[model samples]
Target: MSYMNLIKEKDYLKILIAGVINRFGDSIDAIAMTWLVYSVSQNASLTALNFGINFVPTVLIQPFAGAYVEKLNHKKILVFMDLLRGVVVFLIALLTYFQCIEGWMIIVATFLLSTAEAFRMPANNALTPVIVKKENFNEAISLQSSMFRLSELIGTGVAGIIIGLCGVHVAIAIDALSFFFSGSIILMVKAKSYLRIEHQNKIFTDFKKGIKYLFHTKCLMRICLIGTIVNALLVPINSLETVLCIEVYHMGAELLSLMGIFSTIGSIVGAFIYPYLAKRYTERQFIVSFLLTMSLFYFICILNKVFLNLIFLFYIHLIISYFSLGAGAAVLSTYSSVNLLDKVDESFLARVSAVCVSLCTAAVPLCSFLVSFLSTFINVSDVFIVIAILSLLLAVLYSIISKKRWLE
Candidate 1:
């Protein structure tokens, strides 16, 4: 189906709008939160800790949240999450405005916000299959990815201006309002029963079933393992980009926001192209190729020292690396979403998605901690190089293993 037709579908359209608005808010929140933590603590470790805090709940709470997602109404879950997150962000803004916000408070807020997301994501994922026709799933997913990236691009592009003009508190306040808007939009989505499980099992029983299904499915298992390793290594690099921009590059908020916008531009392009690409390549082939290419770009980025004098050259290299990685990530995410829908029974979908999200993000906090700790002992650039090398090795290993038709 064409993009126009996809948007014409009322339920899908509502979900897309809500997702885009929420992501835009999140992009702004990311900049605001990172800057807020760094400004307060003046410690790179603390900054990294702030980023890692968002994922901690995903790792710890999502597995059980997934089972509950199956039991609850997806629409209600989405609405409640938005309302709860809105209140939390608004409270943070109030604290910031009062000059009472501290690094620990930011961490606490992040943990709470992510807790809401932990429940929201699985329900949202499970709801997609309910709204979109099976034949148009790829197109719908791709469009959703693109919309999300577009929002990121816009939010990041404007975030620096907002911060420079108003303040971090203002950006956060805007984010809080965006959540209300998202919640309101989601309310208009008219969908029937989102839960497919007629008789809900015990939460632990459901969690066990999700875990069993994940392990039993070799293709999904392989994808999850590779994704987890890659995320662990890459997340720290992303978490520290503000440090690199401000401390290492001697740039400011505007430059950091510019970098974010450029990176998201690549992601948007990648997401836009994914539907067509999905039609041509097998999931395994697409994933393998994207990973290898992304790894190569990452390696090339580490060679920035060779052209240190030419700032333009460095920018070009960074943009290319970001674009390649963003595109690869979009493709992989699209594939994974579609694959899960095809493989898991509808009753088990939310729990399975939650488990997968949890596993994929399980190592992020440790990696973030390591990055902050290791940067004190080793050069930050050297730490990134280590991650790049690991990524390359994983890409090659995945290529070799993907020779089996597990996805088939």
Candidate 2:
């Protein structure tokens, strides 16, 4: 399907606009949040732990959030979640501006923001199929992914300038306005769903049903488990990114912002090319290709970190390695999401997405803690290399399983 078809679907286009606006705010918040955590707590381990905390509520709440969202109006859920997140961010901005913000306050703010997201994500995922044609799923997903990355690119660039001049509070306050804008725009969308199921059972029972359904599906639980570990291993690379930039290199927020800029550049390239790549490659071929590519880059990141000798080499390695890593990650996420959507029934999408999202979210905090814990016994750099190798081993395991036809 041509991207033009997607454009003509005005409802989906509205949703895309909402997504772009929302993610634009999120990109700004990401920078603010990262620096805020580190600024409040100077310890690298604590900073990583707090960074991971943003996703912790998703793991705990989304399974129930999924089951609950199954019976509700998805559009309203989107609006509510947007509003709720805006309020939380606005409060954070206010506290920061007042010079009354503490480390614990930042943690609470992140927790509340993600709590809204726990409910918001499942509803949005469930709502999408109703807005767009199933035939154009990959194309739409790719376009959405590309736009998201592009918005991040622009948002981070702008955020750096904002944070440098105005302050983190201003950047966060701007993000708050974006949420309000996105929520209002979504109210203009005319999407409705027939998938609001009436459940006789309690939410816990519905949660079990979602899990039971996964157990019955081929490689479903297995896939989520593997994804959890791989995601966990991959997270420390990002979770401790602040430490890497600040302590290791003596560079600060500029380098941190540059990292996001480079990543989004790679993500844009990857997202635009993914639909074509999906058509050209088998599922096994696609998975193996990205996994192997990611492993290669992880190795390169290690060499660049250890063999830090030249300023030119440092920037060169950062650009090339992160760009390639970012591209691999974007392609894998797009393919995996579309593949999961294809396998799931429309009615079960919210719950299943919640479960899948839960595991994926669960990985980050667990491993972020692991990174901190391991830092006590080994050098932080060593912890990174160990996790990178573990992630690579997942690729090897999947390659073997895929060859044996365990997965399509």
RMSD of each: 2.1, 2.1
Candidate 2 lDDT, 47-109, residue by residue in tens: 777767888889999989999988888889989989998999999999999988998998888
lDDT of 1: 0.81
Candidate 1 structure quality by residue, lDDT tens digits, 1-408: 477778567898999999899889988988888888888887877887777878999999999999988887899889989999999999999999899999889888999999999999999988888888877777787788889999998999899999999999999998999899999999888887376566767999999999998889886786676567557756755788777667666667887787778778877877778777777887667666665766676566567656658988988887777777777777777677767777777778888889988998988987887777887787656776787677678778877776766645
The models' CA-based lDDT, in order, is: 0.81, 0.81
Model 1: lowest-lDDT 10 consecutive positions = 297-306
TM-score of each: 0.93, 0.93
Q: Over all chains combined, what TM-score does candidate 1 have?
A: 0.93
lDDT of 1 at 342: 74
